[model samples]
Target chain A: MRGADILRFSVHALKGYPVRSVLMLVAMAIGVAAVVLLTALGEGARRYVTGQFASLGSHLLIILPGRSETTGAHPPILGETPRDLTLDDAFALLRSARIRRVAPVALGSAPASWGRRERETTVIGSTADFQRIRHLKLAQGRFLPEIDPRKAAAVCVLGAAVRAELFGPEAALGRWVRLGDRRFRVVGVLAPQGQSIGLDLDEVAIVPVASAQALFDSPSLFRVLAEARSREDLSRAAADSRDIIRDRHEGEEDVTVITQDAVIATLDRIFGALTLTVAGIAGVSLVVAGILIMNVMLVAISERREEIGLLKALGAASGKIQLLFLAEAGLLSLTGALLGLGLGLLGVWAGRELYPALSLAPPAWATAGALAVGVGAGVLFGVLPARRAARLDPVQALSGR
Target chain B: MIRLQAIQRKFVVGDQTVYALNGVSLEVEHGEYLSIMGPSGSGKSTLLNIIGLLDHPTSGQYWLAGKDVTGLADEERAEIRREKIGFVFQLFHLVARLTAAGNVELPLTLAGLPRPEREERVRELLAAYGLTARARHLPGQLSGGERQRVAIARATVTRPEILLADEPTGNLDRSSGREIIELLESLNRQGLTLLLVTHDPQLGRRAARQVQMRDGRISGDGRGG
Candidate 1:
């Protein structure tokens, strides 16, 4: 038959049984929508994490005190002890040509009391260059002075939230706040920078590294933050920092140095795999939809046996009969896929509105994949029913046996 | 022209081989109006099905228009059926979903005629069948006589050389049955070959030639008025 006529006939058949057609369409549509929405969520999470890490600053590297793994495959008889990374090791990293700045970190929690207002909060101890290296901005006064490394100067910077709590909207600069047993003058108030990488920047207090070491009564530093001069120098800066620390610790190499690119790359790999897995799980629903189409088409064949017989008696070839049935399946699935595309996009839009921080958009591949699978499922699942219709005995069918 | 030689069709019914058509040979010239009449289980319908190429005889040699068609492939038979034959059934068998015009246009559509020509032919055929006003009406909404007329229009839409009908008036009322019989007779008189199968002796006797079947074989063959 003419292609147009075939399409018209199939459309007429579907319209004849609106409920059944809608059922199949809904099954296929839900399957496609599931794939799209779930993949959007997975990809949104990936983007969120990538954006979080991006805000930490570019060409950055972090140095931790302990190695995550031992050198040899054999288990350490006494759990290989790690050497402490101190301020001296942090100063030594500045000697590398590729390293632009290094800030030794000492972290501890202490209660700060200003008159009657007292709140317990985390204290981050680093050098004056920490402001530039970590991309911190001052709202009032100046950051800690570039002072002698060995001198213990009592000066502090209050985060936006900490300033608000202790000073109560009044000027927080030049105020003395007692932290634990030590009293430090607040030299600066940080700008209102929100949370990043799980650390609430607004609630923390920044102090000079020597004063924090004395306040916390600890000799070892928590970590060291370093910035490379350029993107190309990041790897070299990381290697040089590790080597410098290893040499200062008498060749122990106990410190772990991680570049920002490496961390972002690892996160990307993890999230990429997660997105694929989520999409694959959603693909199972498509298979279920395909099976539904098969079941419905089988029922259609049985119900339309007399119609098939009539067509055959009207000189329709077996191939034509098969084609007509397959056309019906294809039309249903294609329509369903289109409906699902709209639904998935609507879902993504709703999610974005509810959580503005997340970049939730359906990927192009997901849309294309959904469409391909939809039509392919219809045609593949249609084979058996179409063949059955084609193979029907016209005499028996006409006799309604 | 059509010819069937020693046509044999057997049915295996629970270890009993029932002969539906046994070594039945028949020939029909172009434009000849013929009818086959028999009681139930006498294989009149079976003979019609074989002649109409809806069923294959187990062992037979059949020729149509001087071409051997017994061993023809399914698609080739379908092509011949499309071009050279049309069928009318007792149930009218109009596709319930299709409009009257759509039903009449089916064979032309199947033959891949262009839309304009197919529509034109359908309009002409519907007007000829006195169903032009009901062109958009579905079979369910059509009367018995109207449905049969639509079926006849569908059957001859491709201008087939022969029309095979089985119990064409079996489901119609007396007046509708008379109208259908007269229509078939008029088509036969217009030099279109007609082969009808029926059990009604009155309708059977109206054909130009009659063949009587009993026990899977032809018992009598003679010319009528």
Candidate 2:
């Protein structure tokens, strides 16, 4: 039994029944393609969501006003509402720990303009530290400068989209934009930050906190945007800020200190579950493909009964007979897996181009896993037919026409 | 080289027991040519099949080369047949898809001989059987006599100690039959034990010895000389 001989015989056997061989190969291809497509999708979704979270500034934390419930009653009534985060609490957090800089942020919707072009935009009001805290970059001019207390300089950084639409290719920097009744000078134009999960970062307008508060007729307190000296001290610095804010508000627990890492972990859980759910749904096709393989193999065995008998009469061992059929199954599946892997990689590449936000890249492990799954199905589903062929009685088989 | 003591072969058909060979005793020595003559149901083919190790008797002691082969496994029996016995059939039993040379090389291939050696042996056997020119012809392309010659060449390529043929000449014309008998006799003269089954008494008498079987039992045995 030369390997060449077995291979040659396999080719001959397959050629003897072209339609059946093609059908078997089709079944194997479906199985391998399903496994590759589903697993790749799972990996792509995870990367997409993770990238979105990373762009949102992983060092920042969100603080909402509430006393988070730690205990519950049998007949639950509403929990206590804590005092709001005020200007004093923001100032107190600024002094706590080794925090390097802080910007009191205030968010409001305002109709903005730069001479005859106006659009309703979300206004983020903060100080110079807001630029470093949110990783904002300037396309032109400069960001707001650090100002003295109670100083209200009317300057703004126009987002890329707002600048393009309002100024129509003109230099937006050093121009004046009206926010509500007051006019603010365009100190800078922020670079284009593409959409993250459908929220267009390029559509926003940033202004100084004092100017925004005075123009909107708001209170002095703000949504504090803080930055640490280093990312390593983020957890400790966040806890210290919470303590200070808690103390200034008379331990009222009004603010929620949630780190970007915490939010990312939550997002990972949601995306991970979604990927698994889709993969599980696609797994049904693989199982159906396996069953089809078994059925086709059984049919092949029945059709080749006489050939097997002739080989047996020539003194071929039972193990050799089993090996031949198993080889057929393996060859069919291996070819299918290779084709499916190439198809899957091409699909991932195409998907990445179609949706750059998805950022699809098929990992090496995915290719290897798909190949293993294909060969394993071949062996597993091939066993029954191989055994049946091996066990056929030569006397009766030879007698069959 | 071959002996059977009180061989009994039975088959059950619809709850009725049929005896293919019952209480049959025979012997064939090296270089001896013998023929078994009987009707279709007289167990002639059954006895030949038993001697070739293609079929087993229900109750019998079969000795080949002085070893009791009655208890041998199927693989062991096949090995013995490959090494020590050759078989020819009435229909030639040539693998229809194979060329004359390929059919001749089947035994050598089954014996796991190297490809070059097997091909060389097939060439020699085909030349010896006067089929060298038709070696590339498939069984379908060759005449009945040529096909039988290829089958005989295939059977004898391993240089077996015994040749068991069932009606080797029944399907051939007289001239072809005579040629096959001459070939078998020449090989017999070279010390191969030959047991041939035939319905023609004239063909049976050509052997050195003859045995007659009627109704699953040996009816007569005598020296043709």
Candidate 3:
């Protein structure tokens, strides 16, 4: 048949029973929607995770004590754990030509006070490089400097939430604060940096590394946080940092030199499995939808038996009859796919709008796969009914006695 | 021209085999007006279906235009039916969805004629059959005679060499039946072979030749008019 004739015939066939055609399209739409939603969920989760990592700082890398501790052979967050990294390792990496900037960090929970207000807050001790490496926005005075490292100046940077809680409607910068009986000057207040890994960045205090070491009274450096010049040199920079730390530890090979790429890969592996699990469950629903489509097509064939016979008697070839029914199935599925895609995208947009934390985008592969699957589903479900219609004996059909 | 030799058609009723047409031999010449008369079980319609190439005999040599159509496949038989013959049935078999003009235009459409020419031919044929006034009416809206006229127009629209009618008047009143038969005979006079099937002898006698069947076999063949 000519394309126009086939289209006309298919349209007539669909219009012949409006309710049935709508029902078929709805069934297909549901299947397509399921696929779209599933893909969006996986994509949304991935985006959320990646966004969190990027917010922490894209150029960042963390230098932990060792692979043995991170690999779960020992308690990583325990206070009794010994540090294989030292201040010398931090200095060497900072002096390296391939590296951008490095900061020595000493993290410990302590009681810090601003004026008459006192609250338990996480105290992070680092030099000026910490602000750039960790993407901190200064809401007030400047961050601590590397030049004043050994001066033991009583300077503290208050987080936004801490500033709000301690000194409402009052300037926090250049104010005197106390850290566990030690007097400090508050020189900066960071902008509101919301929760990362369930802990709010703006609820903490930043202090000089010398003051942190003095308060902790520890000779060992906990960890070194470093940033690379660019992503291209990340592996080489990581390897160089590892060699410096290993050499400082007398070739102990006890320190873990991890890069952003490594963490990103690990995060992807963890969530890729999760996304696959979701998709597999959704795949079951699709199979059920496929079965529903097949059953419906079969019913359609039986209902239109006389019409098929009439068409046959009208000199319609068996192939034409088969193609007509197949086209019906394909058209139904394609409509469903497009509608599902629209609904899925709308859902993603709505999710992003409603919940900024859940960042959502429709995955490229899933969108394309949904359409391809819909066409495949149409053919799969259509073939049996088309064959049944095509193979019907015109004589018996006409007689229908 | 159509011919049948030793045509046999059988059906299974439980375990018993019932022959609808058994060892039936018949011949119809070009432009011949013939009627097949029989009781319901005597295979008049079966014979018509076989002769129209709508059915294959269980065993026999059936020829249309000197070709042994019994040997032809279903698709080949359909091709011959499309090109050489047209059928009018007791039900009129006008596509319910199509208008009178569309019903008449179907065979031409199947023949792949251009749209303008198909429309022109359809209009001319509907006008010839006195259906121009009802050209846009559906089959359900037309009178029995008008419906039969539309059926005849549709059948003859392709200008087939032969026109076959199976109880074309069966659903119509006596006057409508007479008008349908007259219309068919006029087409026959115009050199289209006409074959009619009916149980009513009065209707059968109007044809130039009548063949009577009993128990799936032809019992008598005689001049009708």
User: Which one wins on TM-score?
Assistant: 1
Candidate 3 differs from the real structure by a C-alpha RMSD in angstroms, to one decimal, of 3.5
**Candidate 1 residue A316 C-alpha distance from true site, Å:** 1.3
Please give the CA lDDT of all the candidate structures: 0.88, 0.76, 0.79
Displacement of residue B79 (Cα, Å) in model 3 is 1.1
Q: Candidate 2 — number of clashing residue pairs? A: 0
Q: What is the TM-score (0 to 1) of candidate 2?
A: 0.80
- TM-score of each prediction: 0.95, 0.80, 0.89
Deviating ranges (above 4 Å) for candidate 1? A69-80, A113-117, A164-171
**DockQ winner:** 1
Q: After superposition, how far is residue A2 of candidate 2 from its true place, in Å?
A: 4.7
lDDT string, candidate 2, A190-261, tens digits: 999877544576987888777777877775443565666566767887888878877777776566666566
lDDT of 3 by residue, A326-345 (tens): 88877777876788778777
Q: Candidate 2's interface RMSD, please?
A: 2.9
Query: Comparing 1 and 2 by DockQ, which wins?
Result: 1
Taking the tens digit of each residue's C-alpha lDDT, what string does model 1 give over A227-319? 999999998998898889888888887777777887777777788899889888988888888889999999988999998998898889899
